[model samples]
Target: MLWPFGTTWRPMRQKIRGTVDLRWLTARSWTTKWYPQGIDLGTWRGRRTLAVSWFRQDRMRRHVASRIAFVDLERSRHLDVALAIEGDDGELVPAQIHAGGLAWFGDRLFVAATGQGIWEFDLAALRRVRGPIARRLAGSRGRGWRAVALVAVRTRVHPVALRCSYLGRVFDDAGEPLRRVLIGEYRADENGRIGEFVVPGGPDDRFERVDLYTPGIANMQGAVRWGDHHLVSQSDEQRAGVLWSGHRDSLSRDRIPLPIGCEDLALDLEARLLWSLGEHPWRRVVRGIPFAQLGFDA
Candidate 1:
């Protein structure tokens, strides 16, 4: 086993399947444009689905297209409906690109961008929905760094403080936070298009900088909130997936192996299933493990 972390795969019911689309291999993050980034259990077009965020659209060839496709999770044989987000101006092509972590708050879906600020959309219409939102979160000089996962909880989900009950994270592909792995908790701000990240992990639980991953956990991808904790998917190149679970303040935590480079994670708590999504789901998707099998009780 090449894995230096824990080898004992926790006992949980596992189910794996994928939609056999003859499309090219895409839907990953920090590696290719076809790579997908985030996953969530929500409704699309008024139908329940396993929502997955694609970095850029793969119209056989990669281009400037962003999307949030769906998998029919409620059905016995799930259907994959891949739709590139269209502009509100009535154009049928993708209006934006470079999408990352996604979270739903009220009537809007908040999407993290690599360079752009968070993009909001009205799920039912499948169109770009921008609100009259602006905040002096970072004054004139804003942080244009790339962002990853997000969490918009009604209450403080984890043992952390919050400004607006909405927390988001940004990634560093420039190799700045890779060695130390910036694991800090930031407050919610309206610094749109991949909002600015500020350090506010509090005094006792503050983690301005923490040394995580001695050998590194590949390129940091996307994440999702599980109960009071967050599970971050660390892409092992583009072949395998490693999941790192912990609170924002806690860095050194559990490393659970997953299939393909799961750009994001979605937990179906009712079924005790952990939906680990990767790129190339149009071709194949490897599913495994339950949320409880990770040795953590919810």
Candidate 2:
């Protein structure tokens, strides 16, 4: 469960061998290089695979673009570049999405595209039909749907979805407003815009809202669901590295060290590892941390 990091922490036997090394890949040489903001591991056609999304910035125009890429976790090699989705073409189709987070539920991939909206991609279709579906609620405009963190809910049949946001409101499966919990401080009137909403829901139009985050956090960056607990991470202009836990009703006002400066986070559930990407020119470095040693325990 733990790896030796100098003399700071004790070493726990690892099931997988080889030191953790981050490999960088590029499709083109732009001013901004792509970074791995989020990742998901799952099985398809009896083969294990890894899915990743990129955070990019256009130095010339100062514009930002988010793209999705996949690699074989079993093989640890990048997937065919053609299959990866960039900007609106991938999960955030029809919208200019900047992916902030990602998670897996059953065989489906859920991605959080800050400002644009959340998307649910069919893993089977990615290999079968080569496309995903954007599950938009009726009359919903995808407002505050960005900055999403997805968690798997325990239930019968398929897993449920849980989403949180930088803005206040949380939602159930039907996109109905749910209660809110504390995230952090807010600046603008709409700074507390809801980014993601997660709750217990079923396939038959039945859903229930469980927990929510209150407005205040300017921008929610990263989130992870461990067992029944949810850890949300954020940063601000004054301070950086804020972590909040929904399952424990706790928050860390102090900043923590992050591999990259991003509002998004990804978790490798099986390995109990966390992954983050840095900003544009520095996107080559992907940071990995152990979940068991986050220091915020319930």
Candidate 3:
């Protein structure tokens, strides 16, 4: 069993028993087009597929017309555009999904837009079925509501959804109360740069403090679940890094060093490897690090 400096995993068995070699299996580049900020690996029709959202320009005109697409993992090909938001005249509009936080649940894709709130798309229909516009609270307190981070949890009834924000609220799938996480009192430094307060997990099971990596900034770009802990990618305008934490009430955190220039992350636990999706040309890269190498026993 590989144990980190401060965290532990049960069963304590080493999943990958030998030294792991990391390599890039394939690379797909986008010409001038921008890929969405998030990616997830799942089996579709018995084949592994990489589902991704489309990126949009920051200008207002471009923001209202964006599209989302998916890539087939096994074949290393891009799938057709799965979902597109359009204006009343039927022109495609851009969704405000930030870089690296899209999620897939069951046969659906969920994305958070700056103007559209939380949008849910059905895989079969390739259309958005619902959005969480009403549930969006007013953007105040110097936080931007335009960005969102999502984690999907499976439940007996249906898949439960959890979302985080630049401000500090965690919401359920229906935009209901999961818990309000306190990120600490925000204050400006001498240079007027904002410094975030370090608050750990609260009593609520739905919310956990996640600022150890990117300290004051509240941008949690992406996350992947491995056993009981979730490895998260957090970044600001200049730097990016990774952090891990067990689900709420456990309060175990392990911060790991990620390869530089990694914009998004996905985990293949069965293979004991981690994948990184880079920006711009949108190349898919793989780094095989043994589970034990990460300081956790199998």
Off by over 4 Å in 3: 1-35, 58-69, 86-100, 114-116, 127-218, 236-240, 245-256, 259-261, 280-292
lDDT of 3: 0.37
What ranking of all candidate models by TM-score puts the best one first? Answer: 2, 1, 3
**What would you estimate as the lDDT of candidate 1?**
0.41
lDDT of each: 0.41, 0.41, 0.37
User: In candidate 2, what are the lDDT values of residues 24-89, reduced to their tens digit?
Assistant: 544322234344455545564455555556555444533244444454455554432111232443
Candidate 1 residue lDDT tens string, 59-147:
45544544554455544222222233333664343334444555543344555544433344554432222111110110112233431
Off by over 4 Å in 1: 1-33, 44-47, 55-62, 76-93, 105-107, 126-218, 253-255, 280-288
Local error of candidate 1 at residue 75 (angstroms): 1.4
Instruction: For model 2, give the 10-residue run with minimal summed lDDT.
Output: 1-10
Cα RMSD of predicted structure 2:
12.5
TM-score of each: 0.52, 0.55, 0.50
lDDT of 1 at 254: 62
Which has the higher TM-score value, candidate number 1 or candidate number 3? 1
Count clashes in each candidate, considering only residues at least 3 apart in sequence or on different chains: 13, 15, 15
